[model samples]
Target: AGGQGEGNGLTQLPCPLGLVVDQLGTIYVTDDGNHRIMRWPKGATQGSVIVGGNGGGGQSNQLNGPVGLSFDRHDCDHCEENTDWVLASEPLSHSFQTVKLTHHLLWTVDTNQ
Candidate 1:
């Protein structure tokens, strides 16, 4: 029910490389061109940055060239309280990381590192 274009909102997604849907119908996107991860609530008009989106850097909260994403469903000791972690791959930085949704924290656990 809307148009997508160049702006600072849901309509403005540049080079979005990855997409995923959660158990509750939330949509997650890796806005590669913008160097950020965006979260769109079901039927929402705009998306909010869950991670990155603060320019590119190696900081704990920044992401550069995020390319892929997935939910970690395996039952591992690192997962607490049955929470699924979101894994993101930033190819340009040669990095892969896991984000803990419960605490909204990003961890650098890329095998390439």
Candidate 2:
């Protein structure tokens, strides 16, 4: 889903750290350098940001050094249902944030708590 260099563009990835694929082969990538999560559908040359595209920060819409990702299976059995939640690890913020598949910020869990 990325090209030759790091960038915020659909075909670029800057320091991509982690990724997960759904049952339908849609790939979800954690773009750490860009502080966003990218969704790349199978057979697509480009991808779209599904979370934290507003640069690195502590805000609900931002992600600081998002390093890891996993799908929360307890909420939904399938990713295509748009009811599954993505758990993202934000090392820079010392927290984990949950983003619904519909691209909504659900909540954040502070590791320090």
Candidate 3:
């Protein structure tokens, strides 16, 4: 239901290049034009920006023309259970990064290289 618009509306997507879903049925989309990553829960009407929402840039907290997205699970010492991570590809910046989903929170990755 998303298209060319903004905010929490169903028409907030300008250019979406990639998307992935977690085991919990959470939809993650790489909104290219907005230079941000958005998340929508199952049966939800609106989506929320989980990362790169500040604007398009090369900074760790920003994304430039994000294109692809994927998800994987990894074990972590800090937590007793396995955690989910989302892999994002910013083609315009030639950068690839990972974002960890910890306790339903978004943990930005360190893309310092």
The lDDT for every candidate, in the order shown, is 0.56, 0.63, 0.58
lDDT of 1 by residue, 3-34 (tens): 48654465578677777676557677777766
Q: Which residue runs of candidate 1 sit more than 4 Å off their true CA positions?
A: 1-3, 74-113
RMSD of each: 11.1, 10.9, 12.4
For model 2, residues 1-113, the per-residue Cα lDDT tens digits are 78758768889998888777765687878888887878788898898887777877655666677766655443221111112444454422334456545554444233432
After the best TM-score superposition of candidate 1, give how far the Cα of residue 48 lies from its true spot, in angstroms: 0.7
Candidate 2 Cα outliers beyond 4 Å, as residue runs: 74-113
Listed in order, each prediction's TM-score against the native is: 0.59, 0.65, 0.58
Once model 3 is optimally superposed onto the true structure by TM-score, how far is the C-alpha of residue 50 displaced, in angstroms? 0.4
Judged by whole-model lDDT over C-alpha atoms, candidate 2 comes out at: 0.63
Pairwise lDDT winner, candidates 1 and 3: 3
Instruction: Please give, for residues 1-113, the per-residue lDDT of candidate 3 as tens digits.
Output: 38546553445887877776665677778777777777788888887776676666655566667666654342110111122444454432435565655464334342434
Model 1: lDDT equals 0.56
Itemize residue pairs with steric clashes in candidate 2.
none
Order of the predicted models by TM-score, top scorer first: 2, 1, 3
RMSD of 1: 11.1
Task: Give the lowest summed-lDDT range of ten residues in model 2.
Answer: 74-83
Give each model's clash number: 0, 0, 0
- Which stretches of candidate 3 lie above 4 Å from their native place? 4-11, 73-113
